[model samples]
Target: MYRLHIANKNYSSWSLRPWVLMRQLDIPFEECLTPFESDSNWSSFRTFSPSGLVPCLEDGERVVWESLAIVEYLAERHAGIWPTDDEARAWARCAGSEMHAGFSPLRSLCPMNCGVRVRLHAIPDALAHNLARLDELWQQGLERFGGPFLAGETFTAVDAFFAPVAFRVQSFGLELGAPSIAYVERLLALPAMQQWCQAALDEPWREAGHEAEVQESGTVIEDLRRLS
Candidate 1:
């Protein structure tokens, strides 16, 4: 059995990627969730993950770190990690890679906080650009591949890559076009996402750094998380 190490679901967007993918696809793995320390997780995480990062996969003697790397590692053994169609698979890889490497502004400006409803102070130019690009990419995939998931009729790695964005859009009330908005709604409605959200809301651990980042980004209108 594989052991997947991850952090708090509310704040760790990187952790969400592989965790959601495995759950949604019915891939078996033991989840080891270690909530972030109020101070720092570097020393603690280093014990299991070389990079001291969450979402590290331990497969027998081998270890895989990084969200994208974890996805690819799973894809090697999983049948439906990516689309089977040649063109769809290529496009999914490109889009998923773009998500892994790009979208810095959206990531920083609207950090993932699943249990909070926040009103942003302002949408900076960079954030606006990121949203525009997200809209464009999602539309292209849906139009080309046809359907509810990013790559096709079924969910793929690309959709899992953007799962955190769905939480972000909901938490910050970020606006997108009709199709993209629908896409976000669809993702949020997924059973895996629903489970993640419930776990987030039920969590009592709140790291100071993550809370500070949320306050820095915007005014938190509602905090649905359970009291610490």
Candidate 2:
């Protein structure tokens, strides 16, 4: 049996990675939702994960922390989690690793808030750099491997790694034209993605931590409320 511990469905980008991957792949696992208020409250996470972080995977006695590490572990067991072709697998792994490590500016400036539909006043240099790089990488994969998903027709960990970004793009209105835009739409339309988003919508526990994180950046309109 496998247990996956995740934080806020609305705001925990790292937590979304493996959760989406596992759910999309139909891998059976129990999910433990950890409510987070602030960094100080993170110590409570240690009960389920020694790392004191959400998205930790426990497979019986074996435990894994770090988002990418969990994905890699799952990939080792489920061959379908990664691309079958050697070159494509390498590309996918590289893309996943890159997403794990780089693009700090975009992540910081545009926090993943699935509930909101907001737009920035202006595109700052750092964020623009990250977005440009993201669009380039996404487009490259679509053209090179022939998409709908990043790396090919099938949804893999690479797509899961970027899943939060798709939500961010939808919510924040970050413009990544052509196939990148279409790709984001496709990701959002996935049943697994819709399930995650709706759970976030239904969740009533709004975290102060997330609100404070994105409050000063720009304007935000909670999409659900607007629709209502």
Candidate 3:
């Protein structure tokens, strides 16, 4: 069986990706929940994860770190982890990769806090730019591929990649075009997503950094930020 190590359900957005993907795809795996307090000897993430990041996957001797890498690995094992169509798969991969690499500003301005509700008093210029780009890209994908998801009728890796962004949109009350809004609702309504959100709400341990981020409303700096 695959072993998946993840951080707190309340804060670690990266951790959410593979967990959601595997769960949604009905891949059975053992969950290893590691809290973020690594200074303590109890923290297991430091020892096994090469990058010391959550969402590390262990399948026997092989190890996969990074959420996208884990998702890619899953795609090798499970058909339809991405889209089935060649062109749709390519578009899905492009969208997923873009989500993995870009959107630093949205990530900063509105971190995912499933358990808490936050409202951003002001939209930073950089953040606004990112949102606008996301809106355009999202609309284009929906128009081109036809969705309730980024790719098509079924949920693909692209949806998993953007799932946290859905959390951000809802958590911070960020505005989006009607299609984008409906898409976020569909993402949020997924069974896996709902399970994660409920788990996040049930978490007893809180990270100070994440808590502070959720409480703070205005803008964010590069050194600090967050989600799903």
Candidate 4:
């Protein structure tokens, strides 16, 4: 069985990507969750991850780091990791790569914190640009492929890559057009996503840095996290 190294369910957006992918696809993997340390996780994560990051995959002797790499690794051995149609597959890969590399504003400003609901002070122009692009991209995929999912009728790696963004949308109450909004809601309602959300809300440990970042964007109007 594969062993997946991850971090706090509440704050580690990167960790969520591969985790959700594997879960939704029914790919079996043992989860190894390491809660974040106050100062730095570099030393701790370095034990298993070359990049000293969560979401590293350890499959027997083979190790995969980076969420995209992990996805590709799994794709090599598993079916349904991506769309079957050549066009859809190409578009899915491109969308996944864009998510892996771009969206700095959304990634930084609207960090994923599933356990809380925030009332943002304001959405900056940069974030607005990102949101507009997100809407456009989602609209394109949905229209082109005709789907409940981004690529097609099924959840694929592309949907997993954007799963954390769904959490961000929920946490910050970020608004989008009707289609995108419905898309976000659909992602959120997935059984896998709901499981992740419950775990996040149930987590008792709180990392100061992540908590502070949430404050940088908005007032946490409600904290749904476990108090004890």
Off by over 4 Å in 4: none
TM-score of 1: 0.98
Position 46, candidate 2: lDDT = 84
lDDT string for model 4 (31-57, tens) is: 999999999999999999999998899
Error of 2 at 165 (Å): 0.2
lDDT of 2 by residue, 1-228 (tens): 799999878888999999999999999999989888655656788888878887899999999998998998998898689999888889999999999999998898889889888868678999999999999999999999988788998999999999999998988889886889999999999999999999887777777768766776768766663233
Clashing pairs in 4: none
Q: Is candidate 2 or candidate 3 better by TM-score?
A: 2
Preferred candidate (TM-score higher): 1 or 2: 1
Model 4: worst 10 consecutive residues (lDDT sum): 219-228
Judging by lDDT, tell me the better candidate of 1 and 3.
Answer: 1
Please write out the lDDT profile of model 3 over residues 1-228, one tens digit for every residue: 999999888778888888998899899999999787725423467687888778899999999999999999999999879999898899989988998999998887687777666657788899899999999989988998888788888988899898888888877778889999999999999999999988887777767776676557643322112322
Q: After superposition, how far is residue 139 of candidate 3 from its true place, in Å?
A: 1.0
Error of 3 at 38 (Å): 7.7
lDDT tens readout by residue for model 1, 11-112? 999999999999999999999998899878999999899999888999999999999999999989989999999999999999999999999999998999
Q: RMSD in angstroms, all models? A: 0.8, 1.7, 4.5, 0.8
From the highest TM-score down, the ranking of the candidates is 4, 1, 2, 3
